[model samples]
Each structure stands twice: as structure tokens, then as C-alpha cells.
Target chain A: MANQPSIHAGVRALARLKKRRRSEAIFRAFGIAAIVFAMCALAWLLGSIIGTGYKAFYQHSLTLEVELTESILAPNGSRDPDTLRRANYRRIMQEAMFTRFPDIEGLSSADQRAAKRQNFDIMSTSGGPNYIRQMVFKDPAMVGQTITVRIPTSDIVDQYLKGNLNVDVPEVQRKISDRQIAWVKTLRQSGEIKAGFNKRLLFSTDSRDPELAGIASSFVGSLMTMFVTFLLAFPVGVGAAIWLDEFAPKNKAVDFIEININNLAAVPSIVFGLLGLAVLLNWAGMPRSAPIVGGIVLALRTFPTIIIATRSALRAVPPSIRDGALSVGASHVQAVFHHKLPMAAPGILTGSIIGMAQALGETAPLLMIGMVAFLTEIPSSLTEPATALPVQIYLWSDSAEQAWSERTSAAIIILLMVLVTMNGIAIWLRSRLEKRW
Target chain B: MTENTSKNIKFTCRDVRVSYSGKEAVKGIDIEIADRSVTAFIGPSGCGKSSFLRVFNRMNDTIPGCAVTGDIRMDGEDIYAPGLDPVLLRARVGMVFQKPNPFPKSIYDNVAYGPRIHGLAESKADLDEIVHNSLKRAGLWDEVKDRLKDSGTGLSGGQQQRLVIARAIAVSPEVILMDEPASALDPIATAKLEVLIEELKEKFCIVIVTHSMAQAARISQKTAFFHMGDLVEYDETDQIFTNPAELRTQDYIMGRTG
Candidate 1:
């Protein structure tokens, strides 16, 4: 031991300490890099979504005063509902458009009607006619009254107003022609067109016209499907966990079951979709594309998640609590229900919420169950045809039109908001139910 | 006290053997416990004293792979007979563990758990009276009277132990078993618990397992010495402590051997 010099020993110790410090620094650098990478990716996703989607919430419209004449609206000069229903309100809208632009009226005979029809097409095909029909039906006596109403502009004009169409691009490649673009500029200068809240996009359901589509039906469908998923998964998962962890005898069969349950949690979700197709749809003959079928598929996918969570929660409760209950003359069932289950309830609830959130965002399984079908009407029952929110976003993106892409991003923003709100509720519930041992 | 000493036998064991997964933990033995008295079982660590005590109320039945053979009877009925429910036996014979294990509930609820499970009370008022009497007997009513709604876990170690005792006695069991009930307490609390046990023996038969021979000598009227899973000596406490019958018992009592 004395052969080595004291100064050499100190130098060696310092060299080892320096090597350890260098490794520790490298580990810290790797951790920081991982965190920064994640944050940057998240920020990029949100920024792109918000930049493209903000315009879809607002729509551009043109205001016009239409003179409803008795000769065109009520030919018989009668107040009958059938006569009013058959009235030629389309001609009135055309006349109104002609009055707004007198240049079209002064054109020669062959050109005048054609020009009028071409200019009037800027308004939504259904919006102008539907407005006049509603007006005359509500009050038949006012056949000559002039009323002012704002109507949605054409989809291309709306996109142009939102700066989606580049005026700098060559005229051949641009969707809006030079004449239509000049007219839109003149209308804006005269204060005849303005941007307002898009109530149609918020209130209406699926539509063939991109300008009129909304997610109301899909939102309702998602709510219904999630409710069913929660109802089926929560109680069943908790019960299975209680039985396996507390009451079941330790044996070879139970050990096999426990291992299989863990493996089921890691299985690809689409496999469950195939299972649902064979078992629930084919064998039971359930209706295709219904929220009930979608919900059942998602419940099967979420069951393993909840079971694993509940088992760990039940295991976390100390064994002394069980002994305490049993020593006081409680039956096995009573001991579990009274002492162990109550203590594990908060953890179980948190797990169920997380499972439900996962089910909400799942798209691949939903697609297999035919939850991606087009639906226009809000579902009134579990058996009705429906599409979920994530499915709506998927369908809109697939079409890839001018305004549909914007609507897809808008739907994505809404989905993220809902997910954030659900997670917030789960956190609040956990805090409220947290107990000190 | 003298009159209570002559009470009839409350528990009878004959050739009782306990095995855990084919390995014997307690060998065959015979013993009788008198009613309304305190019997203490003292032994070295891992000597099967706690296992033998668990056999009285069939608490060992909850452990997987544990088997008990031979006759153990209470009130002239075999405890291990077919159709004999351990639940009923547990209700008749309550237990308190070495460590204080009060349920995560209010003080009133902790004392009320046993009676509630056994359906011993006719009304809420009846339950309240039973809880009140149990806590008073356990010597915790005066210290925790006003905070009946407080959690039992909030109490000190000694108070929590007493709360468990109160909970056990709430069902009005004829026998109460304690497994090193005071080993966790301080000297002052241990003295208080000894006094409470003395008082409790007037109404219920008490069996206690202890590692402290001084504690066994102080509180128990009869003592059993266990060594290496066998009963080395069984006699009156004074006789066993002063004049041990077996060489192993003498060596153990003298702190020379285990």
C-alpha cells in the first residue's frame, strides 16, 4: 500500500470524479433535449391549426332589400297555404339581384337573363329561396312589402374574402375571375358585404355544400357513444378487479387469467374492431353504423385499461385494512365493499376517466365499426346512424376542398378543447377525493 | 376476583396441529381456558404463539395454504366441523392485532362497525348507546367524547389501539383475543392498558400473546410458555414464573436460553 505516492492517489481520484461529472452532464443534456423536442412539436401543431381554422368561424355575407310583389308571390291573390308554397320565389330573388345591379338589367334580351342568373348565383342556392319562402309563409297579407336580409356569399367569394385565394397569382390559376373580384371589391367599398359570426356553420348538420356544413350532429353522436362506453366499462371493470384481487383463490387458472388480462391491454386496438365486427355485428345482427355498435367496440377496448388501473389501486391499499375488517366479524364481501373498495375509489374513478378520454380520441376502431358513415341528422337514439367528432374531422380532411380543409382543422381544435376539459375534470376529481392514510 | 377464577372452561383444545403448506407451524397440543379470566401466551419470536392464538377464533383460516387438524371447541361445539361457519365464530370471538389498525373512518363509525355487521342494534339510538358504552369500557370515551365524528386514524398510537379494542367489543363477543396489544405502546400507556385488561376480564374471557415475560407475569393469571413450536410449560402465572416445571421454561424465564 505504501508503494504508491499520496500525490498520485489524489490525482487518480480527481480523474475518476471528472469522468463521473461528464457523464452526469451528458445525461442532463439528453433529458433537456427530449423535453424541448416535445414542447416544440406541440407548439407547431397548435400554431398551424389555429392559423388555418380561425377564419372558418366567421362568414362573409351580402345584404339586399328584396321587393316581394303580389303578382309573382301570390298569383291567385289568395291566402291559401298551398298557393303560397307553390309561389315562384326564385324569380323574386332574381329580380331583387337585378335591381341591386342595374347594369345586368340593361343588357340585351339574350344576355340580360343570363347575366342576371349568373350574378344571382353568388348567393347560396337555398339561402335566398328559403328566406323568401319563410317570409311569405309567416305573413301572407304582406305580399308587397320590401324586407332587408343578409345572405351568405358564394363559397369561392367567402374564401377570397378570408385571404385564402391569392390575388397575386396568375388569373388562369385563381378561382375568382377578375370581373368577380372587382365587383367584390366595389361591394366592400360600398359597405354592402361584411364578415359576421357563422351561425350556419355552428348550427347546421352535414351538407353537400362545403359552405353550409357543421359538426353539431357528430358532436352529439360522440357524446352518446362516450356515455355508453362509460356505462358499460366502469362498473364491469371495477367488479372484475375486486373479484380477482380480493375474492378469487390463488391457483393456476387465476394466474393464467391475470397474465392474459395484462396482455389484452397491449393488443393493437384495431384487432378489437375486428372482434366487434365478428361478434357484435355479425352474430348479434346489430345495426351497422349505429352509435350503440360504436360504443360497444370502444367499451371492449377500454375494459382492459380500467381493469389494470383498478387492480393496481386495489393492491395499493395496505393489507392491514383487510385484516382489520375481518377481525371485526365482517364477511369477505362486506370487508371488500366497506373498507378496501372505498379506499381505492378515487384511483378507480381517475382510471375510468382516462380510459374514456382514450376512447373518445380513438379513430381506427371507430372506422372499422362503420362509425365513419356520413350522417346529416342528429341521432335521437343509440340505434340510429351516426358519426363521431374524430370521424367527422377525418371525412372533411379526405374531401380536401377549399373550405372543408379549414373546417377539418376547426374540428380538430374543438376536439382538443374537449379533451383538455375532460382531463381537467379528472384532475379536479382526483384532488377532491384524495385521502391521507 | 377469586370467584371469577373458578369459572367454567370457555375453550377446549385437544391434539391441535396447524400446518402451513405441509410444514407444521404448531404441533399437537391440549389446553383449556377458563371463562372470565386472562390467559397469556409467551414465547420467543417465530415460536407459533400467535398461530395458536389465531386458532381460537379461526383467524388462521383466512391465510392461504394454512390447515388446522384435530379438535378445537368453544361452548362444547367443534369449530372445525362441517357446516360450521367461521363468520359466526368470528362474531362470537373478536380480536385485536399487535399494531393499531383502526379503519379509515370516524371514531363513532369505527366503534359501530362490529355491531352494524352483526345487526345487534335496533335503531340509531341503540347503536349510539352501544358505541358509547364500548368506548367507555375501552377507556377512550373521556379522551375522545367530543370528537366522535373525527377519523380514528387521527388519534395517537395508544388511542388508536383503544379504538380498535372498543370496536372489537361492540359486537358483545364472549371472548376477546389480543396479539401483543401493548408492545407498541410507551410505559405509561402500557400500564393503562394493563388496568383496562384487568377490568375487561370481569365480562369477557381474554387471551393475549406477548414477547415480554414481565408483561405476561404482571397481567395474566395463567401463563403458557412456548419454545420451538411446542408448549414447554403451562401453569398459574405465579407458579410458572417462580418455579418453572420444564428445563426449557426455566432457561427461558431466566433469560439464559430460548
Candidate 2:
């Protein structure tokens, strides 16, 4: 053996080593290229979403003082809430806009009607009427007083003011006429048109007018759906994992069950929606478009992911921990619950959170369950008709309006933020609770 | 076996055998383990010494498809009887493994685990006392007394092994099974463990499986040599090393073959 020549002592060995090093370097370059490509894609996606959607967070509003004509708002002299609510606030708003731009009155009667309608389009259709009604309802004494208030501009004027509309396009091609653009410019010169934080976008419910639309209803629905999903999926998934990993006897039946569970994780999420529609909605007579049903469907979709994650987490715990506990005279139950489960908790929690995040962004199954309904009132209970954030994004993205596109992008940004936050929480929990063996 | 009949017998085995998934590991064997003494089972790897050691406390029951068929009695009680609960039996017979497997908890909790599970200690004070005494007996109290609240996993390998020993001792078991307990330890730790085992045998029946013939000769009173799942020799430690009756045993101890 001592007389044997060393294979590693020559130029051939060095060349072989250099070749191995070069291959490793090439592999590393490929890995880096893949990562760089992924990063570029993500950055481009975020940049486009933010660049188009950030404008939706700020809105142009017209600040004007308009005399509330008592005869128009309270013709019966009855200050009752119902009488005030049913008053002609739209006429009052039109008069207010006409007073702001008096040139519309000089046009011919046939042209004057068109000019008045164009002038009225400068103010938000819903915001002005809702604001005046709320004011009159809150205080009947203010019927004759001139109130200075900030009212949201119509969606077209808002787009024009925010530099989103193409003024270079012919007046016939643009949604906003050149006359309405002049009125917006006059308001801007007088400091009456100001851009401020779009509180309506976050505070109000869904509206036909994009200027008045907000995420409040869909956000609430998402919260409720996620709450139900977590409540149902976590305990059941973890319990099933624990039973299968620690207690179930190793046999053909158990193996078959495990294989089915793994296969269930690979099943398309829409299948769970169909199952929910069949079992939970149709057979159970559950309410449609309700968060409870949506949550149940999402729970069905999420639990399989959670189960796979939890089983892997439980498996990651070294068997020696079980042996250690067992050798100390602990029963199998105690050994698992006291030692193995605690050790597996971090991994399980990370898996559950990731599952929940996936469920939050899910839209197709929700579409099957009728969660795509346009909900205007924020859901007050789990059974109320509701639209989740992803569903809202889907609904808005399908709308045939330029304004809805930006709102859709804004909703996407919000959904991405929520997913990122959930992933952050998952990472934090894994780091905080993970124990070194 | 006849010479040890004068001492109190803790375990009596008749035609003991172990198999994993229908594959025989430990062939039929008959043996008696004396109480309050160190008995060492020495062999090369896969000789079934570790598998046989696990049968004492029914640790083999935890492994899937591993079966032990034997008439094993402890103090005239059939340990393998169907009515016997392994959990209760294990409290009376503790075990330490090859690698230090301390619970990922504080040093104090590691020692208190066995007593807490078996409900041996009546109060926190009693549990603390049990932990202290166990650590002292394991010869680890002085090294870890100041940091009892620190994680057991953070301790050095040697300290971790002693902590595991302390955890086993905290239960006050009548029998202690050590399966190559010092195989992962350095020479100094192994020496310390040998000394601790020497002290432990005065009260507990210590059954150890070791690959080190010198370790067995140094600490054990009775020595059993296993070869190919068979017990080739069982005699006084001195006799087994110096004048083994079987040629296989002689060749193994003399380093002629594994």
C-alpha cells in the first residue's frame, strides 16, 4: 500500500479539480441568473401596480360654498328626517355647480341644457347628494345656511385633474369634454379643486361611481372569511396530523389514507369550492355569498395544505425526543403532547399562516360560491352577503371603465400587502418559537 | 449463573428472542441478571446487545414491527405479561441511550421530567430535592448548579450525557439500562461515567451494553459477550477477559477479529 502511487499528486488531478471548480461556478451562475430573473419580474410587477394605483390613494375634491335654498331642500317646511332624506339634493347640487360657473346660463336653451349637464358632471354624482342629505339630516336648522364643504369630483374630472386622462386626445374621444376640463381648470386656478388623501376610497363601501368606491366592505369580508378559515382549519389540520404522525398504526389502510391526503393537497382549489357549493351551500341550505360559506370553502382548501405542513413539521422533530420522553416513563400521549408537539409548533404555525395567506388571495373558488356579488354595506355578521378583497379585485378588473382599472390595481396592491404581512408573521413566528435541538 | 445464585436476582430470562419485521435479531437465549450490581453486555456492532437491552423496559414496543418474545421476569414478576403497562414498568426501570438525548428544556426541568411524569415528587420542594440529589449522584451537580435554568441542549456533550443520566436517576428506578451510554463521550467523560456507574451499582441494578471491553472490565462485575446474536460467554468480568472459555470470545477480546 505504501508503494502505491498517489492519484492526486499530478497535473491531471489539478486539471480535474479545475474542471470540477468550473462546473460548480457555472452552476452557481445559473442559480444566480434564475434568482435575478425572478427578482426582476417581481420588481416590474410591483412597479407597474404602484405606478398606476398610487393615484387612487389621493383624490381631487371641489371645495365650494353653496347656499342651501330652503325651498329646494325643505319645501314643506317639515324638518322630519324622512322629508329631509327625500328632498331634491341633486337639483341643489346642480344649482350649486351652475352658480360656480355662470357662463352656462348664456347658452341657447337647447345648448344650455347640455352645458348644465356638462357643468353638473364636474361634481361627484353620489358624493354631493350624500353629503347634503347627511348634513340636512344631522341639522335641520342648516337648511338655509351656505356651507363650505369638500365634495369628491366626478371620476372623469378626477382623472383629468390627477393627470391620468389624455387631454391630447380629441374632445370626442375623451370621456371628459373640453368644456368640463375648462371648468376643472377654473376650479383649480381658484384653489377650489384640491387633491387630498382619498378617505372615501378606504371608508365607504362599493359604489357605481368609482370616485365613491372604497375597500371597507371587502376588507371586512376578507377578515371574517380568514377568521373562519383559521378557526376551522388550524385545530382540525393539526389534530389530524398529530394522530397520523404519532398514533396511527402503520398499515396499508393508514398508508392509503396518507397518500390520499397528499393527493388532496395537489387537487385544484376550485374543486373545494365546488364541494362547498354542493355540500355546504346546496345540501346544508347555507346562505349564498356569506362569509361563513366562503370561509368554510376556504377552510376546506387550506386544511390540506396545513395538514401536509404539520405532518412534515411533526416528522422534523427528532425521534430521540420521543425516545427521551418515553424512557422517562411518559405515555405515548404525554411523549407527543409534552415534547414532540411543542417542538413542532413553530413549523405548524408557519404552515398554517402560509395556508391562510394563500386562502386570502384565492378568487376562483369564491367565484363559484357567489362571493363575487357587489356588496355595498360592510358585513356586520358572518352570514351577511359579502365580497372578499380578491373577489372585489376580480369584479373591478372586469368592469368596462377606465376608473375601475386603477381601482383594480389599487385592490391588488392592498391584497399583496396583506399577503406580505401574513408571510412576515409566519416568518416571525417560526423564528420566535423554533427551538434548537 | 450458579455462582450468582447467591445474590438477589433482578431479571430472569428464558429463551428470549427479538425480531424486527420477521427478521431475527436476537436469537433464543437464557440469562439471569443479579440485583444491585453492574452487568455489561459487550459485542461488536449489530450483535443485538442494544436490542436486548431495550427489552428490559419494553422500549422495543415503541418501534414498529419490532417484536420481543420471551419469558422475562423481574423479581419473580413476568415483565412481558399482557396485563403489564410499559409506562408503569418504565418508571421502575430507567434507560440512557448512546447519544445524549436531553429534553430541550432547562437543566432543572430535564432532571425533574421523570419525577413529574411518574408523580414521584409531592411538591416543588420535593421535586427540587429529587433533582439535586439525582444530579449529585450523576456527578453533575457541581458543574451545573449555577445554571440550572439554562437550556439542557446548550450544555457540552459530556454535560448533556450526565444531565440525561441525572434525568434517568431522578425517577429512582430499581433498574437502569445503559445502551452504549459512553460510546459518544470522550475518554475523560467516559472515565467519569465509569466512576458514576461504579457508584450507581451499589443501589441500582445496572445493565450496560458496551463495545469497549476495557470499559466492561473496568466497571462491571458480570460480563456477557455476544457474537452474531448469540451469547457466547457470561462470566465474571476478570474471567471473561483473561480466560474466556469460547474461542470466539477469546478472539474478540484479544482483537483477533471483530
Candidate 3:
């Protein structure tokens, strides 16, 4: 009976081990599922952004050949460049549309005007007029000449080409009417309608017309703001970090400062915006809506991040390293600068770059400082009015247009690309500076 | 113990006590370290043997909240004098740690670090010669001569330890302090290092702390026994191993107690 009880205890122990092993396997599966789920979520987000945004990079346009008759443009019959410059370019484009659709020309005068207006609406709001003005400015000699040019189509037609405006939908519910769809089809069949690289959308500033809008101004703004943020944050952040980490004594005041600095990093970013408004704009008398102010505000927000990163980097340097240098007769300053700082450099630089990237995406603080203004020109200096890429994306996303949605997603793609590139550089730099010991 | 050795004293300590954060680590002790000899301190763990060795070079000064008392003089000069700079003092008394802590640099740079900081060498050629001689003295010159540009950390543990020794000697210090220098080495490397230490004693005052009684008896000229932060006994290596003066020292050396 004693031997039997011992054998039974052995079986019970084996059963308990089996139960533990099963739970371990289940935990392993859960971990793998969690990782797969995270990866799938990220992939899904990228997939959707790419799918919708790629269409914005290329736009549909209708190519046409039309006579720029002097009667509609320079009605005075004088080829004076000034008069040509002052000519009615929109009417010339309308006449070109009428020429393309001669059926509209055969209609009665009032009906003809209506048909002409409808045809003109099919062209891009700014591309047709802007193209005429550019040609006239480039060559006054082409006033009476017939030139073939490609002009952007309207957003509704652009949507139709991208299959966003469904033809299967009821005509009343659709942005494009049946007749307009038939005209688009005819143009497509005749090889006149084509998809062209959207140079205007890439080059132009913010516009009410989605087809004419671009992020050029905001890209420059982000560059300038981030530059200023870097200039302010890097030296000050690193200096403060070095002092606090290396020189500060372990007193209650220093301890309190360290705690507050960490807490500052976790504070809501919008609170920084309010502080910037009160300090930089209201009290300091700095210009509002300027990149300089935006940069300062962003620096304040990113300073804590850089400091935290730098202190950790400094801490990672082994105390044995300082001991080695000091043991070799190097002074405290010499040991830190010659050995400790160099060893800690890669980590510091990586942290600074990450902080800069975070500053690049910040928008709420800029909004409080009036960077949400509809800036049309690219900023050339720190003191100029500017808007960042994320703010531009925000502005476009708020517009009530089908094409604006695509542009919004496209801007998001660019932001993500820049962020990825920055992080890649940080990783590369870290590896380059990595030491085995 | 020796009839022909010079009567020069390299270090003299009187009532030296060291404490960390108000906890006394090394109780009051008095000792004199002779010039041009290897003096070893042997004790059990937490006996403050390493702390006592660090007093010679003022290496204990680096630890925060570590307070040192009493008088420690090197070559008739008070090390804790008001006008003395620790940096210059360290150059005079170089140190090698328990673990080999070579900088994350090439072998040549690791040795050149001390000479460069002290400005001991005037030109590149002088620095090169110093590095060569130091490595030679450490018995590491031949193995690393072809690969001086390789990282110091890339070497084997024993090689790295010898490299650290070479780095310490490059500063041309009068006294070199080593803390458990051979505790991490294998039998062959330990034998090689013990031989190097004996040879180094001809030119520099060497103070070493060790855990191995045999190691102390083999290389050191004099051995000091410590227990619980107090010096139990100190004498010539032969007398301490064969005929200890204290009961605790005899018990420790006989492996009867610690």
C-alpha cells in the first residue's frame, strides 16, 4: 500500500506538469496571436492609405487644340503685350470648349450659351485659365496661333475616372450627370482624355479647389520650423542633460527638478500651446503665425523628450569607463568628454532625431500660435507665416470635397515617408556608432 | 626579510579608516609599504581588503559618500593636502581594477590614453616607444604586436587584463596598485601574470590585493591579513604563511576558518 501511494503521487505530479505545459503552450499561442494582430493592423492602415492616395498623384485631364482668336482676347485689334496681358483668358477657354463641341455651337443663342457653360464646367477650375495666362506671358506671338495643350478636368470628372463617382448610381445622386458622363466617355474613346502627372497639385499652394491644391508651402514650413526647433532644442537640451546627469548633487531640490522634468514630458502637448501663447506671443511680443514662434513652441514641447533620451544615453555608459579614464590620470572633465561622451554620442543623436521627428508631426501647438492660417506662399525665413504638413493635411481633411479626401491621404503618406526615413537614419547612425563593449 | 634592499618607504599610513555612506568599511589600520616590492593584502569577502588597497592611489575618492580619515603619505608628501590635485596624484600612482577595464579602443590607443593625458610623450614616436615598452613589460607585446589596431575588448580575458596593466604602466607611475589582478585568470595566465608582477617590482612599488593565499605566497614579498575591516596580521610572506602571528591569521592560512 505504501508503494501504491508513492506511484499514485508520481502520477499526480505528472498530471500537474502536463497541465502547466498546456497553459504554457496556450500563453505562447496568445503572444503569437497578439504580434500577428498588431502586424495586420499596421499593414491594413498602410494598404488603405496607399490604395486611396496613389490616385491623387495623377489626375485626369482633357487635351484640346483651339485657336486663340484676337477677337475674344485682344478685341482692340492691337497686339500690344499689355493689352494681351489684360485680355479675357476665360472667354478664350470657353470659345475653345465651344469649338471642341460643335453641337453646342449649332444650338440657339441662349441654349448655346447654356451648353457652352456646361462644357466649360467640365474643365479644371484653375488649370484652363492659368494655362492660358502662362502661355500668353511666355509668348505673346502665339496670340493668334492654335496650340494643343492638356488641361486638368473637373473634380467630378476626375472622380469619375478614378471610379469614385459611380456611373451605376442614379444620375441625381451622382456628382456627374448622365450627359457629362457620355461626354467624358466620348473624350476617352477619342483618346483626348488622359491621366497626367498632377504637377499643379504638387506645386501650387493651398486652394479652395482641391484639384489645384498642393502641400508645397506646408512642406517648406515644416522644414523651416524643424530647423529652428533643432537649433534651439539640441544644444540646450544636451547641455541641460549633461549638467543634471553629471554635475548635480543628490539633494532634495535636484531630486524635485528631476521629477518635474519627467512629469513635463508626459504633460498634454496642448498645454504647451497655451504656454507658448502666453509667453512667446503675448508677453514676448514675437510675431504670431510666424515659423519662429511655431519653432519655439515646438522646442518647448520637444525639450523634455531630448533631455530624457540624453540622460538615459549618458546613464548607459558604464561607470567602469569613467573609472578607466580617471584611473589613467585624466581629470573628471577630461574623462567625461574624452571617453564617456563619445561612447554616449550615438544614443544621444538617436534621441535628438526622434525628438525632431516628433516635433515635425505636432500641429495643435502650431494651431494655437496661428499657424492654421491659409498661407499661400512658401516660408523663406523663420519669421514668416507658415503652416506645417500635418496642419495642411488637417486643413484639407476638413474641406467638403471628394478630391480633398484623396489629397489628405496623400499628404499623410508623405508625412509617414519622411518619418520612416528619419527613423531609418537614426538606426543607421546608431549601428555605425555601436561598440561591442 | 631582505638584507640588500633599499630602506625607502613608498607609502605610510597611520590610523587610516574608510567608510561608505556612514558604514565603516575599513577600520583604523597603520602600515608602511616599502619601495620596489610587491605587497599583497589577502582576506575574505567584505573584509575591506580592496578598500585598503585603494587608499594608496586615492581611488576611493571616486566613490560618492565614501569618506576617508587619518594620514596617507606617498614619498613624504600628504596625498590629501589642500593644494594637491587628484589627477596629478593618479598619474603618480596608477591603478588596475579587479576586472580588466580597458577602454573601448584599439590596443594602441588604450595604452596611449595615459601618456597622452599626462603629456609624458612629446611626439608620436615617443608615444609609440612608450606603448611598445609598456606592452613588452606586461608580456603582451609579441601576441598583440601584429594587431595593435584591433579593439582591446576583442582580446581574451587574460590578454585584456594584461593590456590594462600595460595601460597603467604607460603613465610611468612610481607606484602601481592592483586589486585582485589574477582572480579572473586561468592557471597558465595566472602564472604568467605572477611572473610579470615579480618582474615589475624591480622598477615600481606594487600593492596588490588578492583572494588566493597561494598567489600571495608565490609572488608577494610581504602579506597582510585582514578580517572584518580590521588588519589581523602583517609580515613577510614566508613568515605569514608558515608561522602566522595571530590566531585568526593562522586559522585563515590553515583553511580552518575565515
Which residue segments of model 1 deviate by more than 4 Å?
A1-24, A69-94, A106-118, A131-143, A189-191, B1-4, B250-258
Taking all chains together, the TM-score of candidate 3 against the true structure is 0.96
The ten-residue window of minimal lDDT in model 1 chain A covers A113-122
Q: Write the per-residue lDDT of candidate 2 for residues B1-258, one digit (tens) a residue.
A: 213423899999998899999998999879999998899999888998999999999999999999999799999999989999999899899999999999999999999999998889999999999999999999999999999999999998888988998999999899999998998999998989899998998889999999899899898889999988888899988899888999999999999988
Q: What is the C-alpha RMSD of each candidate to the true structure, in Å?
A: 3.2, 2.0, 2.2
Residue-wise C-alpha lDDT for candidate 1, range B104-152, written one tens digit per residue: 8999999999999889999999999999999999999999999999999
Clashing residue pairs for model 2: none
TM-score, B chain alone, candidates in order: 0.98, 0.97, 0.97
Can you list each candidate's DockQ? 0.65, 0.83, 0.83
Colliding residue pairs in candidate 1:
none
A1-437 in candidate 3: lDDT tens per residue?
Answer: 54466653677889988999999999999999999999999999999998889889999889988688878777777877788778888888888887888887678999777667778878885678878888887887788889998888888889888988767878778777766777888998998999888876668788778887888899888998998899999998988899898888879999999999899888887888898899999999998888888888899888999999999999999898888888889988888899888998999999999999999999898889888878777778888788999999989999877798999999999999999999999999999997967
Q: Report the lDDT tens digits of candidate 2 across residue range A201-250.
A: 78889988999999999999999999999999999999999999988989
Candidate 1 residues A100-199, lDDT tens each?
Answer: 8888657789976666666777676667777789878998877888989888887788899898888898887976767577768878889888889887
Q: What is the interface RMSD of candidate 1, in Å?
A: 1.0
